[model samples]
Target chain A: MKVRWRVLGGEWQETDTEAKTVGELMASLGLSAEEYLPSIGGKLVTEDEELKEGTEVTFIPVVSGG
Target chain B: MVSCSVCGKPAIYSAKYEGKAYCGEHFLEWFDRRVRKTIRKYRMFGSKEHIVVAVSGGKDSLAALHYVKKLSKRVPGWTVEALLIDEGIRGYRDVTVKDFKRCAEEWGVPYRIVSFKEEIGATLDDIVKKGAEAGLPYQPCTYCGVFRRYLLNKAAREMGATVLVTGHNLDDEVQTFMMNIMRHDVERLARLGPVTGISGQEGFVRRVKIFYEVPEKEVVVYSVLNGFFPEFVECPYARLGFRWDLRHYINLLEEKYPGTKYMILKSLLDIAEAVRKGKGGTPKRCTVCGEPSTKDVCRACELKALLGIG
Candidate 1:
């Protein structure tokens, strides 16, 4: 399974792993999804969301944005 | 020695009337009373026009509205209008706007909200997303400042406000000055005053600063001592890049040169008097709204166009 991580509105990079959950994937990348809100399939996914093949994860930084 | 939270000047010989400590120039009672006095002293309000204050639901803004409204009853000709600009941050904007509404209702001032969604068709979050999408050279503070200013003026115009008041106190002023100077934009550096109303200017609303003289540390102490505002240090995006750097640098400068912020602003005020006396920044008419603009299309319209709105 290809686990991928990306910054929202940014480039996505592929991870060479069969990570079973978002938690595992984040741990692989040495990050916490709390601070960097990760989303999958247009809905925000928590750390418990089990990863499938080609799971596209996005690390959305805490944004005040304006 | 208690250090001034604003200019970083130490209060070597001072008294604490509670947890609020004050130097001679910054005594909390004197600061509060004088700020309340300057509003009346200058007669900045009118009988017919609404005294609309732009609030960010922050500690400073809440205090500003409280004082302004407190004085409005005493002043007679004045009434308070609380204006909150919703920048369209997801949970953040919702929280602040709700707080503003609740506070206004409690205080009995007419409250109105102008959201970025309706006004600009896009939120600050959208702008940030798009910038990240484009990998663009954009500053978050730039977008925030531009959007906030444009919306505040638009809201003021819509509300038919005579004078628009903001929660900018001494520290905010000094930080702005330091930022302008860092960018070598001396013109804005010279324009820091309580009232930023360009005289003889049509279509431009006057920006009166009631906190022109109040210090930021004093504002904080006053807010805390008075239970006027919620001191939430939990802005998610506050710790982001650049502006944080600028803030830290300003604090460092204030530490190195005590009273640097106030001294710089005091001198800038003198310069503002002269610059304001002379024809100021190029004020042209916006082709879209006919309001005062530096360009044919004002920032609001330009932003709307950029975001495919309005």
Candidate 2:
């Protein structure tokens, strides 16, 4: 299945992945679940959330800098 | 869906550290209770204190301001205001400042802005440029951190704030603790706590971190749920510091092993308390600026001399 993901303020890019859930997707991307809050369709979601084909996920970086 | 620990509603947050999940309503209640517990445990403030929230127009600080403002409405004689330090970063600080103003007005909290250009005679852009031109070893964060701290303290004092509040959460604290340990800077570790700085000291406003025990992830959730999350903006110079890399590694550990961050924080507090117990000497006044300092010239003044700015 293909899922769309992007960091906030960045362009969304689609990736074909075998990952079944948000936690798996984050693991595949080498992103820490603690650092990014995944949102689907403008609502925040937990890692157990299943990913569907063409689901757009915006990963909001929770950590602020400086 | 995970059920809320309290009421079995669909869980909105799962706090792995505590082995509990909270639905939207319960999460807010839990988060607020934690905030209150932290404040009470630390004795952070009296009932009648004036709070100056040092906001950077980011999610963390803005969230801190929002909660504090919400809290002060019920506490008689408590007043809440915001103070922002504009480091004058070309693209970042400008955008965040707009968000700050909008939120302040909407929340009915009075706010003041201090800029590096006005206070230090140069914007952060200029400071970075000059540092590069002079072959200075200092990174952008160093200059920004020193000046921001100097201004926040000075501005908060001028505003008659009895206490200054910051939005620093668990992740920031643990990262700093590890950094200090790696650098062998144990004395700085002594300063980390829920309420920091030398209390009852002249020229120093006590700094309180209400979210000292809250995780950054929870902070983001709190802000979003409360409808006050600021527009996300990354500091342009954030990647230049050791902290950037360190933060990622720490978060990775936290992701793999739940409660890693909390364990680190516990270690930090214990170490800090031990260090505090052994400390007794008073801080000296900066010769040039008269701010509380350990050296004759404070870091801010030292930077000013290096940049030839006021």
Candidate 3:
């Protein structure tokens, strides 16, 4: 499966992966679930959710404002 | 693929609370409309008012500043400006101040920068250092929160701003509401609202939260989509306080049960309304700074006195 992941204001990277769950894909991309929220197909997805092929996920920073 | 609820375009955001997805264009439109709705609902300001937005070089504050700047153009006789407070934290604040300045310049909003050292006779670093040396029992945030409010209000008033705006979103507000409830501080809880600071009070600027109802995640998404995103830098002292724990706890709840934050805020507002009707004592002027206070001196003045600074 291919997944496109990107940070806000950063370049998008398309990668081929064998990850089954969202958590696996995030780990494969070296992202922390605590720090980055993953939205799959425009909806927030939990780590347990099964990742489909060619899904576009945008990882948003979870840092709160003061 | 999910399409936008309004227009059948590829969706970029799913507002879980609203149960709707929006494309980039529709999301921006929805975000702006929600902000405008908050303004109108709270009656934050009107035409011929000078609105001062507090920018901390964070995404939330910058997003609030951007939206207010956009909203000002449509409101006749309304003007928008930015205020940045340099807390004088060596590495952390220096970077954000630069980001704030750049955003203000880019947005063409007039801005003023104030510092803790200049206004309160000590930088936050100096305060933390001295507080440790002096064996103060309170945390650094106690001093920072007090002094920041003092400086923001003073600067906004000096600039003739009719309203002082902050980027406090649903998460901040809900976390604060929960913290207050857990502490059982009715006095503080009574003050929580979309709009605060009593009007016609001398030295007190009416403060409004433009993104009060918007979730933190949506604010980040909005900032990114609109190209107004700032550098994500967490305050070094943020995790040292109770609010940090509350924030994470609230985030957990929000993640598990969507719209939990909004429900908390709604409950708080209802409780606040009930408390307001029963509360009667008016605020007194602080003897030291002449600011409104429930006691003889304001919290900022009391903290300053404890720190042995002006």
lDDT of each structure?
Answer: 0.66, 0.89, 0.81
Q: Write one digit per residue (lDDT tens) for candidate 1, span B64-158.
A: 88878877777667667988988777767677666677777888988788877677667888877775666656665566677788778878878
lDDT of 1 at B145: 72
When candidate 2 is compared with the true two-chain complex, its DockQ is 0.68
Residue-wise C-alpha lDDT for candidate 1, range A1-66, written one tens digit per residue = 787788655688998876787767877886633224455664444455678888788765431222
Off by over 4 Å in 2: B279-281
Ranking by lDDT, best first? 2, 3, 1
**Residue B18 shift from truth in candidate 2, angstroms:** 1.4
DockQ of each: 0.02, 0.68, 0.23
Q: How many collisions per candidate?
A: 1, 0, 0
Predicted chain A of candidate 1: TM-score: 0.80
Residue B278 of model 3, lDDT score: 75
Per-residue lDDT tens digits of candidate 3, residues A1-66? Answer: 887888654788898999987778888887755457677755555555667777777777867534
- Binned by DockQ into CAPRI classes (incorrect, acceptable, medium, high), candidate 3 is incorrect
Judging by lDDT, tell me the better candidate of 1 and 2: 2
lDDT score for residue A2 of model 2: 100
lDDT string for model 3 (B261-286, tens) is: 78888899999888877762476788
Give i-RMS (Å) per prediction.
Answer: 17.9, 1.4, 5.2
Query: Whose DockQ is greatest here?
Result: 2
After best superposition, candidate 1 residue B95: deviation in angstroms? Answer: 2.3
| Residue B116, model 2, lDDT | 94
